[model samples]
Target: NNRPHPEYSLKYNKSRENRLIAESSYNHVITFFEGLMNHREIAIPIKHIDFSIGRICVLEVNRDITQSDIHILKTLAKMMYPLMISDKKFLNLETSRFDYVLSDLMNNPKPNMLLMRKKLSNFKFDLDSNMYLLCLCDLDNINSKSKVNYVKQMVQGIFEKHYVFVFDKNIIVLYNNKNSFDYFKKCKEYEEFLEFIKNYTLSVGVSKLFDGISGIRNAYFESLSAINFANRLNCIYSKEPSINFYDDYVLHDLVYDFVAKKKLHYILDSTIINLLADNNTNLISTVKCYLDCGENLNFISDKLGIHYNTLKYRINKLKTKYFIDLKNPDSLVKLKLAIIALEISKGYDLDLGLN
Candidate 1:
């Protein structure tokens, strides 16, 4: 068992010791470089080499460098400075490299259209049927600025292979099948998803999904409508089914155009606001009562427990102020649109005139 001679044993021990020292030094250097690289405020120092040539240079660095190393660094720097000045085109190319990197990241398809369709097939989302797109966004309760990033990450985690886009302040999620709807609706896990979102101040909205890219605009609007409905009703899910934009194209277009152009307040006035405010802004009661009363003076008064004269005065005042005729059927429809638009404008900054 003790076959090694003294010289052999000594050599083995020295070799092992050197190996350990080398490993330790390597690890130390790696750690030092990592720390330096990760330091946010640290920058490589650049020095002017020649004013006439507009040459800039940076020295080669070595830890505990000797005079020879410094001299070599200076020589290298001098050479590099002239090249840098003479080849400004390369510097521009370097700048373009960063732009390319960003573009690649953005377009590299974490989940592209083809991938999304394939993944959705696993979820049994029918490509041929009418679908709905629902987007759920969660806001950060602690740091407001971090909300978008946090929601983006969360959405990415949940919808791993789905395409997501950040439009303004909201995360846009696209869903495209009846199976997808049923799955989300019936899954017990959905409750957990809802809970997780709620913890981060979340909201969910579902849209009527159409067949193509053209339908996407409608789906987006419907999802937003669902969001507005939920907010007004104080409910998590919308009670009504998604509205078909095609079926009601004219009215939808009018409403959308008016809202897009920011002219909704011309059809609703302070009286409507005061009434809504007085009723604790109860959407259903206000809307239903307004419609059921046949825009009649006496009927609304009795239902709302106000004098008939008071109702007439309020109605007349609203008509004059907003220049809207509630008696006409078309104008009445427009009034309803105005109400919905006002509710939708809550979390958004809309220049509705009455506001």
Candidate 2:
């Protein structure tokens, strides 16, 4: 056993020498410990014996150690090394396979789109069985890369059915829906998701459900839109911002979609917008509340924390100054739509008297 093996005489090129040097640099310091991780009763935990590439775990048994038993164990250990190395290599390849296909789809989507999709589908992902929602997290407030990685691990553990990735410093999620849960049911989980983001100074945007591979681009756009909406919502309300779902802002997305389809961004009246943007007084808010509350002045008053008489005065003044006849159902609807559009478009920056 002390003699040199026959393979030691092999010639080395620059690349081989470099590989040897790199291998030598990594501290493979093997650690031995005996303990029970929970209830399993680990007999031996040989930590990082293969340069951070492998760990050996052999659980304790009832029998006493013998020379023959040790020899058999050593033989088994030698046999496992090759399999362990191969498994590690396969896992690395598996982990990075998605990255290559996704990069191709994002960067050059024209050629082999179907082929790339097929390639993606072959990799343990079933398009038909999986419902997808895209998520984008804003990590501007996250202090360090270690924190980002920790967040990633936490999210992955939390969202087990999700495929989480980091692209261009943003965490992107391709979430798989549970077949039993509907949109709102699945969304209940976000309470925890958003809470995590809030505690970690993170904000996230979640896309609406998309059924198939073709909808991936749409889902991404939805996530992007939700992020913008979330940021706007964060600034508008004093409440802490954590997540904004695109589905929650259905009206805003609808408006944008309508404009996109019609190639007309100016469908809403400029005068109405100007009035909403003025923020001169509380008239716009009063009108919005009146319409929103179905003309229930008392409800609106209670919500706004204003006196009934004060709300009435504001409503009457809104009708007078804006030339909006809240008395007419059609006019009230128009005013309400305008106010919503303004809220979606400008948040509180334009004010529309809501402040």
Candidate 3:
């Protein structure tokens, strides 16, 4: 090939040099940005806020906040703070105000801005840094259309530094602040919350409080986990920690739907009652053994101090009475599901025998 012209070669070299320079500069800028991000101070905005019982303080005030605005903020804070501290109280604020505040906050689309300032200022309590969420509310069991609104109001009435959100037909109350999460954990409030749910025929769940907004997604899932746990455990309340919601949602939906439609009891009642009766009403041992042996009659019988033939006889009797064949994999699945359904429906009671 003929030698390239010097000018052409020089021009090409210059272009290549500029491209290398630009790439080097771009890499330098990226490194600098990464350093800045790594070293940037992460502010815990509410650190100074005292969240102790009966110690109320205004957390923030919006800039250019008007006198009417101040009155509204103070009124809301004062009204809501006491309610947060005292869950027994009902809040009856002007419906317009409530709607306006919630709408504004949700739409603000800013971090720690005027809407947050307004909302936080009205709440008189401090948030515990290590908050856990316990969502206590009924599912679609609300008798009246207004009851749904009432549950929202009840949740708002209990709002503190923690964020409260409604997931599905349930109200999720975030319990945060150092000792706040501990309060529920200590008072066995989780259990009590479950009892309240049972009284209302509601399903409830608890989420482990992940810190901050990033953790909010985790908290939401945790709340979902609690709901799933409740469904799987078949109780009004559950604190199950290992439920994989993504894997279990479909299964839970089926069980919840069955229970809601009143079909679960019919499928499970006869089998559960028969199992209980055959086991001499020793509910715990029977369930434990049945579950332990994968519902295998021979294994369950060997473990339960019963003869294998006797176990086989009992299983057959249950199969006949409930129209469920324990030998069939599909039938076994249905029977297990029915047992879980009855367990949850009866608040995890081992003595009820599916009645």
Best by lDDT: 2
By lDDT, rank the candidates, best first.
Answer: 2, 1, 3
Candidate 3, residues 276-327, lDDT tens digits: the string is 4354444434544676578567668778898877766666655565555655
Per-candidate local distance difference test: 0.47, 0.55, 0.45
- Give lDDT tens digits, candidate 1, residues 1-355: 1232434322322232322322222111111222223221111122332112221222233444445644565466556665665666432221223223323333443525565455446645454566666555432212122234445666667666455555434666665454546566575656655655554456667665467443555566666665554554443234432222222233444555555576655554554544433443333344556866686656767887777776666666556754445677876675566555554444344444443
What TM-score would each prediction reach against the true structure? 0.38, 0.59, 0.34
lDDT of 3 at 168: 40
lDDT comparing candidate 2 with the true structure: 0.55
Clashing pairs in 3: 77-122, 128-177, 128-178, 129-177, 131-176, 234-344, 235-344
Put down candidate 2 lDDT per residue, 83-130, tens digits, no spaces.
765665522322356756665555554546578668987777666555
* Cα RMSD, model 1: 17.2
Candidate 3 overall lDDT versus native: 0.45
Tell me how candidate 1 scores on lDDT. 0.47
lDDT of 2 at 227: 76
- Model 2 TM-score on a 0 to 1 scale: 0.59
